[model samples]
Target: MLDRRNMLKTLGAGAAGGLTLAGAAEAEAALTAQASEALGPYARPWSPPNDKDPHAQNIVALSDDYFVPGRFAGKTVIVTGCARGMGRMAAIRLAREGANVVGVDWLADEGRAVIDGIRRDGGKAVFVPGDVSENAVCDRMVATAVDQYGGLDAALNNAGVMDAIYPGDPIDYDKQKSLIMARIDQASDDYWDVVMRVNATGVFRCLRAELRQMMKQNRGGAIVNVASVAGLRGFGGTPSYVASKHAVNGLTKNAAIDYAPYGIRVNSVCMANTATPMVERAMQILRERARATGEGGGIGMIKTKSLLQYSDQHARDSTPAEQVAVMLFLLSPESSNLTGANYATDGGFTTY
Candidate 1:
């Protein structure tokens, strides 16, 4: 019955006993390694992958200078949408900083690959494959964290959909044009419902489950929702996405206020056009439309008018690492007093 608490006590006792300092240090290292190995292969360290490795390419490796080494040691974090993009980056970085991560996503294989990369980097992580829009999946995510790593300490609700989920048929240009370039009047019920379900209600479900777990533990935790710059203001031709993001901000504030007394903090990172798979898909759509319409200036002109909102400071899209930096700060104790804030990681796009 050697639990974590008892194991720690034993280590302390060994340090104070007749054993030399170096001997005690070696003993502790061996015990820690054993404990990690007992968890699973993913908790054990492996050789780093080569540059040409597919999983290695998927990983967004941050410089050692960016890490605070063990800043989140012994913490357990749940990151939704951990398959790729911002969510993947956050999970890897947090694990590198010594947090035990439970990575969740509907993209099962991709999610597992990300978790594998984390483990290979000498970090602990597990993957949960399911959509965040489901209540059961949300509950299961929190439960996995508690069961695996003792309890939940923080979360990043980053799963979301920017566009409507189309059917299995070939591309419907008419529907695509309407969905991407339509106003509220032209947006279909399916378009609005699908986006809202995944982007707005999805976050709400995750937050409810996470907050409940934190409350039961009564030690408090942090939550960072991945909202967007559109949440701060109206963005033309994306009625569903805009409205859904605004809802995310609303949920963040409400939870922040209600949970502050319990020592829990809730905030959001409202990012602008970040360089993600989602954004790349969007650019591809715009490029197709531009070619069809005989438009000039290619991707650059389309991005400025649509994504960057003509802001000079946003001449380039942000990297997932840049957005994850803000997210990690909010989740860390460094932003102890920051809650209920919709932080604009928007490259000053929201300024104007």
Candidate 2:
């Protein structure tokens, strides 16, 4: 959840550098008093003391923290790939927290599910179908959020894809590489260009547009890029996935540093595989590998991580999307002072 770089940030969050779930209330009281003197007695909801319980109850964990209604009420948030996975999760929950949600994805059928879920919960959200890799779509999405929801407060650059074709255990590392290269070789120049363009450059495009709007609107805002752990380390044989993610990580750090003066906070989530469509396919490949090798794999490591069994019981023990969303909150205004950081949402995968 927190890395070495986050040690200082986490330490600053509680009494003597640590606090339990039960200690949040007490820790917040003290944090508030100290923060007031330091930040000049402001009552920003996203401020540190309030960070302890932005909502009454942690929506992810019922009856833990009281739900704070409308914490992001009237604020606009744009999430790409809102049709499914973590992006959908973030959008729906943010809407529940009172943000006007903009859900953009090329898959209308699934995207509509996200919008319906929001509306069903009495939350506001709109579904926009388009290719996020396209600048036109990106621009339309921003405009839609502003025009429909008023103005933007936050954006999650969460759209991306891995090689759907190469999903074997150990990735069959060499075979996967050869296939990807062959896929490129047999394709039109634009095909190879588009794959990298969409996954990597498209992120920069979104960030640039989002930053411009935030700056021009004169509204201090937050942005998150959904990069993967692939970007941080050398993956077995996922060349394009790894390279694109590396670019995402680089973009996030650079943007965070550059946008600091503009009151824009940018951060990225380095996540491991989850039980999403993309991940499931990868999991299947790894499962086959496991069958062949006769070795059990962990929850996230499909190929050969034996930390935990790959069963329902085991996944319940791993980190969930909501936990990663919490990291998003930290990088947002609730963590006004934190920026340029990558939070690992991999249930110790990164640490290990």
Candidate 3:
């Protein structure tokens, strides 16, 4: 068996001493990490999600991006942003566990892929085409689940745009002026609005509508929002994504508190960088910068080296989307009493 300490030493070896040319470069790169301590958008006085699952059977929680069978038997679930990446992965996993899954996405083609994959695996899933930001669209998605699955027992609010990420470095003196001119310059006001509308506001709308229906059912429900590691921390690059998700965390706590009177459980799956579309886009942008600057030069060796390094980190940052879904199950009746918690599905990124 490999010793964890030695393993980490090996991993951090390349990043050692700031002596070699490579080490110096990585050290400089390391300084790009932000230290800003923005507060979490809101406080939690709410119920934790899936606080109910662990007691039902001998079922166990997944540690990585993997799953076991029957994790969510006899449940009806709605997953937003199921068109691609983690959302799609989660939707498929729920269906495989014998839940009726209602998937929503803006990407029609990718949405269909999720449905198709679920069906291929002998699981039930329905793809609804639309944006989660719109009340009408959100309403319709929920309606599809109720209309088809009898009633929604759990809803995973995983739909949201991840268009921004920290650049790992703050702006230099040359780039500081324009940034200082605007309060939301790093991510911009427009960027903030767009992200807030889709990521944070979408959750508010989704949970509000979900709770209203759950209240009508007079039955309890569980909800999980897809927040991020940045939500737990803060950002100097894409401040908006961080801000929006932090608001989501607050929304989860508040909703959990309000809805608990009616037995509704609300929580969030706060993740990190992962091999998702959002991270891919961020990497491409960084690589483009490297190319444009000729910093790493012709072969793009240094650029490739750094990009792959960051890419691997982001990939390791998140568990498989399905792995996080297990927490959603625990929030339901299976676990029996958990509520109002912010579960970190990050690969220890927040521990730092």
Candidate 4:
């Protein structure tokens, strides 16, 4: 990927705008020819050749062309919770970079839409509609990779849920925050059960299935489990969520050690305050709560600091793509030396 990018950069730089059109064209051709000779042809695997077909054109138009292709060429990947947000973004990005994605999610319509988008972009993908919290579904996810793509090369276990306790009113941020910050005694058994089952146990099932398959393949593969910054420390407020994430972190570490001999690298990306749909809803609630209080800084003042220790530019909330970038790194061969590591993509939120 770096090589291809550098070659393109060199080619573009050679086409000086100061030169005449014909001269510039000649320079570009010459540079391209040199690059071909050195790099054995500049291949654009991500996009098909420009043709008169309107369908192909539309697909190209929708495709993310910014990524360097062939990174995961000939690889089959399984992405959980790929209907939207981080999971959706990672699945599409992986497909764009030449991976055959097996996306699993509970939302059938949205999951199919994501798969359709990948197919429209000339990328390979298939959607499996199911809840990851079930062991059968987790097994099926791994089975789909084998049945459809022959074998699984990698997986991004990005399925997890937060403990949401709403105090009746949707717009009342104070009540919402109170419910969120509720202590253990204030929480119910169902609340803890749902969070742990989905976030921790669901991941455990997926990891087991993936590891078993990778071991059987004997080719070795990578796995990146999606954890949260809550796993790293006790920030209070959401006890179930923090505990679940901590369990995920521990599971990632233990699996990494157990599977290292088999060449299966296991790691987790701990993120915080990413601009996901869940976070967006939370922010909106906070904003409304601030308005209701209408005092000298209510939830507004603590909103940012609530998630992070710092409020500087470096500590800004990350986009879905930003988190996926680190996940890709961990899944790729570039991170072969990195295993059993909880990579914090927290944007300095955990620095303190």
Candidate 5:
């Protein structure tokens, strides 16, 4: 009988941790060797495995006694950014629990495959491939949920992008830290516009569309925006990304207030350093950069350390699955009393 605390301990211990000189040395060598494979377009062609079981990626097996299945059963959900990473996983998890899912993303092939995989497993889902930055696309996304699934009950606005040139390096610890904590003057207007368009404005459009649909039904709904730990605090290198996420937090809070009377709840999930496709890709690039500069290879180590310092109990931050569980809880009726919350899934990163 693992208590909740113990269960978290077991899981977090597996991935959480800060850097040790010895450990960083070893990790740097390994990461450097793999850097070549990581350099490419940000989008990974790969999707989550499981055309056969669809729910095979379930971190906690359904058979586990502690597992309470189908919390979202009979609900309709619109999951943007469904082509890969967290969005793909959440879409699958909800459908497995009997929710009808409408998955939207710009990656048409991958997005359709996600839907196909869901349908193959007897879960209801449809893919809408579009950019969330456009208002019309957002409208069509919600409309798909209504037309296909009858109505929308919830949404996860998880699609976002960083600056086209997200800098990472193999520089000294101090320099790396300084570079990451980009000063406003260092960031260009172009960088700000690109990031804000997708991360902030895109989410704004989705919230408006989803809220309208939810309001029309008078049934109330829940929304969970995939904000980053950057949203909660400033980071050095990526000012635009940080600012955009801050906007997400604001939209989430204000929307929660405006829609509470309508029974709609809005919240954002603030993740510190979750392992996702985007992060992995960036890590690869950083590893490559470190090798070029002849740094001691603690680049990856320090980033992990940053996350671990805040969450002493865990070696790393929350998993996409763990984050999804929280997102599900927020969207489900179970969180009826919770609203306007920026739930930090940062492994305690903000506590200090």
Candidate 6:
């Protein structure tokens, strides 16, 4: 008798045996249905926590109205930074949309929880715990997607770092301020190197791996890099972060130009301040600064002011789902005509 693991292995092997697109779709449906049957009634719908913090909202699930059911069926996708925030949401949505997902992150426990949650919801996914800064890890990510799901169809390069290499204690105001709001002259060698390694070089490495795999498969694929508004325009403080994001946008354009002949589409999402854990941590630091110095002008305030000036929406950060909506569109067939485009997911923040 075939166990669940062996059964999935057999299905994956069959998929890799050169099935046509239509045949692959049928196989994919059968795989999902059989996987669900293997789990029986124990499978349950997974939902994000109902947290009071806006940044923590929309962590696990996207709204039913937002996703096109089975849009990513038979496709294999890779998502980075899958432990939390936008990356987490992207992974969940991709699996929910019927994509076999390979989730990569350095946060092992949290990342595994995400993959486990997807499985619990009757979705196919696996977690690879490693930092994208390493080239070997990037290659392994693509390998996992292919080995587990037959082939790679898409990827969301969403892993990134801002401010500091490591988080400081809440009472360490001086350290936090320096890390979060340092000028170019004030930035340290360690600070610049860490940011570039993870943000700029990391995306480059991921793109290289994903593009190579798609090229080898001789089939078209889609990729969405999570850039930032800083990539489009300038921002005070966080020079390393801004420069790294600009590098991401540049890489997106270059890759799209070179790989279009291979039928691969590469694009990026330049987002403003979103309600993510990264932004929330920065906000906490700025709020502390405000209380200590009684000053109002900080990163959060500046972003809020800019958002209010250009958009009709409320003066607040965007939710993770809002950004993921744009990402999913770029990854799906709906945005086939778009390549090398650095789409601003900001609420009109970069217009002026």
All candidates: TM-score: 0.76, 0.68, 0.68, 0.73, 0.72, 0.77
Model 3 scores worst on lDDT over the 10 consecutive residues at 31-40
lDDT of 2 by residue, 1-352 (tens): 1121233245356656557766766444443343233222211233233344563221122111122334576788888888777777777667655688889887778888889877765678998888777889889889998899778888888888675342222455334432232223333343345557767988988887788889898868898888877788766535577788899989989999998888888888876655566576555555565565565533323443312312222233233354445645853567888788777765456665
Can you give the lDDT of residue 222 in candidate 3? 86
lDDT of 3 by residue, 131-232 (tens): 788999889987888888788888888887644232233434244323211125334555566677888888888887787778888878788887876688
Candidate 5 regions exceeding 4 Å error are 1-67, 165-183, 288-317
The per-residue C-alpha lDDT of model 1 at residue 96 equals 63
Q: How many pairs in model 4 have backbone atoms within 3 A of each other, for residues 3 or more apart or on separate chains, i.e. clashes?
A: 0
Q: Model 1: per-residue lDDT, tens digit, 80-121?
A: 999889999899879867799999998888899999988776
Sorted by TM-score, highest first, which candidate order results? 6, 1, 4, 5, 2, 3
lDDT of 6 by residue, 111-216 (tens): 8999998887668999998989899999999999889988899999999988663532353666555555556876777778888889999999999999889999
What is the alpha-carbon lDDT of model 6 when measured against the actual structure?
0.79
* Candidate 4 C-alpha lDDT tens digits along 197-221: 8889999999999999999999999
Question: If the candidates were sorted by their lDDT against the true structure, best first, what order would they fall in?
Answer: 6, 1, 4, 5, 2, 3
- For every candidate in turn, the CA RMSD to the true structure comes to 10.1, 13.7, 19.1, 12.8, 16.6, 8.7
lDDT (C-alpha, whole model) for all candidates: 0.79, 0.65, 0.64, 0.75, 0.73, 0.79
Q: Kindly give the number of clashing pairs for every candidate.
A: 0, 9, 23, 0, 11, 0
Sum up the clashes in candidate 5. Answer: 11
Report how far residue 298 has shifted in candidate 2, in Å.
Answer: 16
Model 5, position 339, has a per-residue lDDT of: 96
